[model samples]
Target: MAKILVVDDDSATRLLLKRDLKLEGHEVELAKDGEEGLESAIAFKPALIICDWVMPNLDGVEVCRRIKSDADLFATFFILLTSKVDLDDRVQGLDAGADDFLSKPVDPAELLARVRAGLRLYQSQLQLSESNRQLSKTLRDLQKTQAQLIQSEKMSSLGQMVAGIAHEINNPVTFIDGNLSHGAKYLDELINFLHHYQKYYPHPVPEMQELAEEIELEYLMKDFPKLLHSMKRGAERIREIVLSLRNFSRLDEAQMKAVDIHEGIDNTVSILQHRLGGIELMKEYREFPRVECYPAEMNQVFLHILNNAIDAVRQIHEDTGQIAIRTFPRHDGWVEIRISDNGVGIPRGLVSKVFNPFFTTKPVGAGKGLGLTISYQIVVEKHGGKLECVSQLGEGTELAIAIPIRQHRPPHSPSDSTPDR
Candidate 1:
């Protein structure tokens, strides 16, 4: 049952409304004048209020205006009672926030019907408010789940990359270790023979001379230095490869730091070098400032975009694909990097869905389709940057990324908690 309040200057009128409304199974309260009605509306928090339009201190119109002005009381339905039956009087009552009007000598049947209608409206408002609260809670929960999934995917990708790099490093290390051992042994044997020849063969010995000729002593001496130099060069190459892997992974870095954008791009290119067969890479870099960002995450962004470009080129069966990378500083304290490829371009219809999670055009087992989605989040959400794509079917595609040189705050703010999807 709804709670209602009745206000009138006439004692008889107030009594009639209170009695009839109570008989209808409603809890009713009475006020002698408009001022009392306004007070009781707040104190009792009634679902509906009925007041006379003409009264001594505060009138029904004034009371309705005050009630509607208060946010807490605005939902309470108001009905105005008046002796005047003119259209202007009705309009004035409505303009002051009266939801309904009752003529003088109010009919009991009509009063009950209007009260029931007002009750229905109040109930619906309450239901709508509750639904909104529940929806907000569901949105928060979904965001939390999304964050967990993204992090899990990132760790899985890192594990696979680390395994591949480990395998690549092992081959070069094994070659360098085996070759160094054999080279040391050969050098030791040659040193001992030369020492013996100089100490014991001060005079000419026919046997020693025949042995030297058979072994090709002059050629061996000249080629030994070259072999040692080759081994040294091989070891150096292995070092460079390991360094590139380290730079690309950035595993030791857990927070934002100033990092060279060009270095990160070069490192990513080196890591993906094996898959770049027949793909010509051209770079045009300008002097740019180091940006404050999560290096590992940024490197992952580059790898994702580049990998997609390479795959697009391969799919078209291009004999010699071209991937061009360009970087320059913007006038607004931001750096822009653009990676373009001449390959099978993305269809216009699918361009919008490229950043959507788990959306892929590749065949089953060939892709997870999280690459571009994760990249978009890293650039736009985490770094407060912009990532855009331009593509033309049958021509090529280009992706541009822009990030500020310095971050004023931490990477993840409250708003950033929500995933792009």
Candidate 2:
């Protein structure tokens, strides 16, 4: 049984509809004009509304227009009752959002059937709308999951390369360190022996001079220590960078844990050191708390952001551009890391779409735009943090990430969520 509102200017017509609809096991309400029908529809919220085309205050077409405008009220089935059988009148009624039209002197059986049909359509539309909303939500989740999976696979591949590169670099660095130490120690003994000779005889004695000449003391004493010290320092620095790269990759550790964030960043820089030759790199480190995170995933985030910065700088200058990386502690107990570069800044229009996956500004294969996108996921979704970028067209770009030291980290996504296959 449905609630039906009958609106008619004629008392006889309204009375007829009320009596006939009630006989069909429906609850019916009667209104005198279009104005009254509008008010009744708002107050009663009927399942179906039956209204006459012509009325004194407001006409049926106007009533339908007003109801339809209020989508909540329009959800109910609206049927226009009319005495004019002309095509024009029927067109006007339908245009006003009327679901059905019943001509004057209507058969009660036909009216009942039309009402049932409109009711079916209204329910079906509501169901379809709900289904569409669910489908859209599911699609979004799937896209996000797919993006995370691709990002993880890319990081894994990069990690393997980083480990191999670091290992290769370590060999030469170790050899250099050993040789420098040996040379430096030898230089210290020679310097002491020279000082003792100078003390024993204000100038070299005839016999001592002959010994010195035979040993080539002049050449050895001149520049040997200085050269060895310089070489050692350079090699040690390279060794440190290689170690940092290994720490950054963390290929052995897949699960999340507490990590010193600075080490991960240093490794990223070391691995990317070759690319930095064309650009000037600067960093300012601030005090930070140890954060619990997946070191490998976070290193990937660093790689992505730094890679973007490097690319941006490459645009404006052929060489000698600046990329600055700074990290500081925030009052909220979160850490803020910012990478800013004086490169070709992003255009105003392109800023909004940067985080969208597979969107690249580079020509064809030169770039895959997923760097910022994947970085955004790591900082914001995985670690319960935030990532943002500020850029101007010609000046440059600044990418900032803020993450809590301890957070309720989001679990692995469905796409990255694999089972033994």
Candidate 3:
């Protein structure tokens, strides 16, 4: 049975309504006036409240307004008991938030019917509230799933491209690197033999002297070794670049492994070396244990953050920029990477939104705006860590990444991969 509260200044009226409502199968409570009615309504938390228009302290219209205003009590159906039947009086009652009005000299049949109607409306409201809550949860889940799918597709495409490029470049680099030393040795031997012949026979035949003078033989002998050394150095540099590319890709070692985070950071820096022309790159790495992580993905995170720092400095048209990177192990089994830049800092208002997908300060087409968003996911969601940014307007920005030395979970699936960009 529904719990109902009946309020009236007249004891006789209160008793009458109580008797009638009880006979109609509702559990009824009594109140001598509007003040008492409000207190009882709060304490009893009734499904419906019947309040008289005239009362000692608070009136029925005021009581109904209070009930409708309260978040907790707003759902309770309110019926105002009034003697005035004038059109304005009815309108005033409705304006005060009354759900329904019962004409004084209450009709028992009419009152019961109205009570039933109010209860039905309340039930509908409850159902709609529940449905809306469920819909919101479903939408959140769908969005998360969609983001994972997109990330998977991106990583898969990137992995394929990087692996192919690294493979093609590695073979030629290895060949040149192996043959360069032999070529340098051969040149050195030839130069040494020519020097010995010159030393043994100080004077040559007139034709030979003329030939040596014409060809600048002395200069050739002096410069040839240096030329070979330069070529070998160039080949070695190319080989180092190829190695960096392979490290950055790390496709074969996609599974969780003990990885040097410093190596990953260095590889990323090497790949972005061209962009660091006027930037002073500083590294303050303290000795730390190899972290268990997906090296390639972590490298990507470093790339994204470093690229952004470079872009920020460039945006201000700075002739020279500064990017400082520091790494150290936290006592609590976590490793911290702090990357900061002396560039145009993120605005205070936009700092919090930096990691939100598609939110960028750059002009349209300049950026896809997914770089930091994807970085946050890789550091936090995939690794169970934290990624945060601190910035001041017109100053600079610092991004801090902290992850456990060893992940607590198993390797992530393709759907959990970081974004390709």
Candidate 4:
């Protein structure tokens, strides 16, 4: 049985069609005029509408046009009933999206047959809609899967490279760092002993003076401490870099653990030091508890966002770029990390699309536009948090990521509520 609507100004015609369709074991609704019919069609969503050719105010054609234009009613079969059988009239009805036509003084058998045929067409339309919906869902899932696979491969490669580099650099840096203090101390002692010898025996042999001059002893004595101090600083810088690399990779801490959020942010910044030569970074960090999260994955989130910030600021050839990072704990137990960049800001209309997969304003070969999309997934889906963006034209953009301070037992599920936006 199917739902059907009958619209007509004539009382006899309405009664006849209603009795016939109801006797056919179908749910039928009757409307007195075109306006009433259009209302019923929308609210009831009938499978078929049998409308009169002409009526007061709005006509059958106009009602049919409106119904066909509606997305939800696009597949509702329409049948026009009229007394005039002129070819021109038929064309006009068809032009208004009428599916089938019925002549006045309708026969019960013909009405039933047409209704059955229209119902079959409606069912076919529904099936097609369902198929299209399923296909769309499958496409979205496939896109999401592809993005994850690519990220996973990159993560694996990066982890291996970072681990190897840190290890190799740490070994040599440790050697230099360990010997730097002793070397500095030894140089100081030798210089002191040389000064004492010079004081005790002011007059020395011609051979000793000639050797001292050849070695530039006066300048060496003055510069030795400075050179040794510089070497120590360099070794320490290398050690710091290596430490940052290891912390950013977090390969050893694969599982969820309590981690310093500031440490993760600093580690990411340290790794990006080469790119920040001309940019000023400002950090406004608030006191917050160590967040329980997948440290490495969270670092990846920071990496993607910071890289985007770098790319944004790098575009402005005239101005020195600035990226500001602010972190604070919310009263609702979620910590928010906001990264704002004063570069070429995103257009107001496109700010929403920044997180869409494969949607990029970047020129070809520059980027794949999956950075924010993947970041959104990690912060929202993996951590059960909210990723929000606020931007204006030429006014820069700020991406705020909010996640819980403590991860729930399920890790992915949320015990506390995250921000809706």
Kindly give the number of clashing pairs for every candidate: 0, 0, 0, 0
TM-score of 1: 0.57
**Considering TM-score, which of the candidate structures 1 and 3 is the better prediction for this target?**
3
- Could you estimate the TM-score for every candidate? 0.57, 0.67, 0.71, 0.87
lDDT of 1 by residue, 1-421 (tens): 9899998999999999988999999999999998888889889999999989999988999999999998888988898988888999888988998999888889999998888888898888778877998998887556545743875577657845874785688687878867787887878788778869878876657997888789998678778867887877788767666777877776666467888899999989988988998899999999987788888889989998999999888878555789999999999999999999998898899988887767776768878777877888889988999999999887989999999997777476643343321
Candidate achieving the largest TM-score: 4
lDDT of 4 at 293: 81
- Residue range 146-198, candidate 4, lDDT tens digits: 88888888887998899899999999899989998999999989999999999
**What lDDT would candidate 3 get against the real structure?**
0.86
Q: Which ten residues in a row have the lowest lDDT in candidate 3?
A: 412-421
Global lDDT of each candidate: 0.84, 0.83, 0.86, 0.89
Better of 3 and 4 by TM-score: 4
Q: What is candidate 3's CA lDDT for residue 213?
A: 95
Instruction: Single out the weakest 10-residue window by summed lDDT for candidate 1.
Output: 412-421
Worst 10 residues of 2 by lDDT: 412-421
Q: For residues 177-200, could you state the per-residue lDDT of candidate 2 as single tens digits?
A: 887888788779979987797887
Predictions: Cα RMSD each: 12.8, 6.8, 6.1, 4.3
List the candidates ranked by lDDT, beginning with the highest: 4, 3, 1, 2
Among these predictions, the greatest lDDT belongs to 4
